[model samples]
Target: MQNIQHPMFALSLIFSFILVTHAFLYFISSLFSNSNYWFYFLAQECILFISAFILPNGSPTVLIGLLPVLIAQSIIILKNKLKVILFFMLSYGLYCIAITINYGASELPIFIPIFFLILLIVIVYTISYNRQVSARERMEFYLQQLELAYQKVEELTLSNERQRMARDLHDTLAQGLAGLIMQLEAVNVHIKNGNISRSNEIIVSSMQQARETLKDARTVIDNLRTETLEYMDFHSAVLDEIKKFEEITGIDVEQEIKPIHSLSNLSMEYGIYIIRESLTNIMKHSQARKVKIKIEQKDGKIYMEVSDNGIGFSIKNIGKQTGKFGLLGLQERIRLVGGGLTIESMPGKGTKLFITVPI
Candidate 1:
């Protein structure tokens, strides 16, 4: 009975020492922000060391205390590498000393290998934890960079939209007003020369142009309110524009529109506007009796060609002509959608516009 109770009493003392020392360490850490707080763990190690020597048959239980210290060291944030290593070595040395003293020196071969194995596992866990922390930090950094890039893109988009709006106004309202002024001046001259028939004809033409300009302005406003192709598909929209061009200019149109399987709304909207502007330029300046338009989707891109047998001018000098805003607007529209445009023309030969946009 005495022997059984003595072993049980030793077990109780071992567990009580572990629990009380850990609790005290927790309390000190929680209540104080001391830089030398890790010393408390060393002090707990010393207490366990002294207690092991005094307790009878305490050598086997010494491992129970040593394992908890090693595991705690592995999990903690290691600020001081040298101090942590020193603490580990001290704990190991004291464990070895206690084992040799209580369990005899011959057991060193068996327990030493086991201790190193446990230490290796602890080292592996520490390395894995550090790698996870580094990976999480890198992911956070990448997310921040992406957020900044998105903001830059959003700002650039708004600036482009403002420029597009200005171009639309120049193409529609400003040019319409300028044309009306020129026609009115011509009407004044004809009336002064007593050419009533010619004056009436000029007035009629000016009225028609005014009506068309007003319609174009309304179309611009409607575009601002909603998407231009919300109700119409690409094919029908292009056909409608071709029909309108024929009726307005009395020019014969040769058109070949292939089936477009996939196109973004942005591409379709800009493409239609480019076509309409091209036809307007033909009517006003080209003086061409025949026009050809071809639209197709090939090689992951939308291709459009507008050709006319018109009295074309030099592409270089076209930029100097203040009234020639059509080409500039076309280029701007193409650029906005990450597309390209090529103009082929000479002083007398026909003019051709080639537009390409990715699907």
Candidate 2:
């Protein structure tokens, strides 16, 4: 309806480029390093304020366009709702001031609707972005907890092994050596007293005991060097877990495994752990009568799904469910091996777990 070339439109073009370019560069650089976004924010507001005077009233609203950019910038750094609202109000105030100075108080009526429209966009975007950020933060917190739990599990395993070794050594090698020494001392006493037959008998008895102790030591060493699932890969491991789970719980399990032969040891370990934990949760929390498990390898990734027909709960209330699936260590476990996990469920509905990991 209105098309007149103005200085303001040309000036606003520069403002748009700077704002978009800075945001792009900031996003990319942020992946490598933190940036001083404050400078970008100040520069944008300054440019938009300047454009209001050079451009005619009929030109595009350069000042109003800057509103969303400001909110986007704030979302990256600030989480406090009050702080976001304050920044929004402050920027809007400065914009209103610029308009008042450039166009006069009587022109306010023309800008009111656009101001409310921008506010709606900012509010909706802020709330949505805030929810996404909160979800990510919670996932991160769960990963940290999983890491800590893994460390504790490893430490406890090592400590337990050391204690077992110590106990075995005392019971086997140490006792054998002490008994040999006592028997030799007795033989010496008998030999000194000229009792050759008694000395020979004692020597033969000590030889037999030494052989038994050596056998016990070898058995312990073998156990220490091997794990229960050392040779089997991830796919077999999941089936094994399901087999055990069904046997113990009396709940029939349905499993589909596409053997993942190329999985790294780390990936397999994490996969088995996830299956184990999932089964544990099922046994403990889910009052389900049946379970289904699926595993497959596709496109250089391992995918797993475990579902059960149990009374389920809301994913929205995950934070409140202290010992539930999402809040627990499965996400963290899957995450450590450079993978992701997703769960779907609802009230009176079954829960399904989807797992993906690089092979």
Candidate 3:
């Protein structure tokens, strides 16, 4: 191993010397056409090279012999004080190698081996440092991507939950309330015709339904409080909200909710708000006779569809209306939850709202 290393070391030293000499000569030649600095630099390099050759290889010398050479190189390569300091430090490493080579040497016999080892160490260190830096940068980049993905997931989850809540209010509690209201009105008519017993029974039933509605409302509030805006069960909550919507709208709002769970509460709330706003817009703008809401969860995502067979307005004009907060608010709410809200409508045609949230 020493034999192989020895020859390689000799060759490397020869090559390095040749390169440095050529560079110095090139600078000297260019000096006449360029600047005096080049001449000074070339002179320093020549003096260093001659001194290294003349110095006895086994001589116990400090870094004094090599220090001037390094300082000269630094003056040429580095301008700013900080950069000069760095280059000086880097160049000083070579002095340490020289010192180690000369340490305990009876003669110059060990110079070749020491030079070879130093070169090898430098090359290996440079490669290893570069690889480590590259790896760290890559890891940081992937970490950022992961954070972004998590944020998007959280937002989508919240929006879906909101949509679910709105649908529930519109479909379940809302419908039940509307029924109770109708029954009461009917009983009122009956009382006018002297059907006192029938009127009393109807009134009692309506009261019961009212109590149930109040309970459901309380449930909604309680669930919202227990779970933060990010981690709520959207499916059941949305169903309840849809029930309420039906009761208030006096419209037959049909729903088909699929069995899906584990959505962020923020997403759910945003979704519910979007649905409520859409329905409100329908009530105010569309004179449709029937409304339908469909919700589906599949492929790690939630989808909602609300359609009304009402007198639809121009899609362009919908945004232009001064009192169009329902439409604008729904859009903004969905966006915040990392979901999308799209409206499809034309004059005299029914309107359809499609909302999608990533699970």
lDDT of each: 0.77, 0.73, 0.65
Q: After superposition, how far is residue 131 of candidate 3 from its true place, in Å?
A: 9.5
User: What TM-score, over all chains together, does every model reach?
Assistant: 0.46, 0.54, 0.39
**Which candidate should be chosen as best, given TM-score against the real structure?**
2
Kindly list the per-residue Cα lDDT of model 2 for residues 140-233, writing each as its tens digit. 9999999899768755764575578667867887888889899999999999999999999999998898898887886565334325455776
Model 3's TM-score against the true structure: 0.39
Give RMSD to native, each candidate.
9.8, 15.5, 15.4
- Model 3: residues >4 Å from true position, as ranges? 1-232
Given candidate 2, what's the lDDT at residue 102? 74
Cand. 2 TM to true fold: 0.54
Model 2 error, position 6 (Å): 6.8
Residue 320's C-alpha lDDT in candidate 3? 84
lDDT of 1 by residue, 34-69 (tens): 556566666667767776766637545656535544
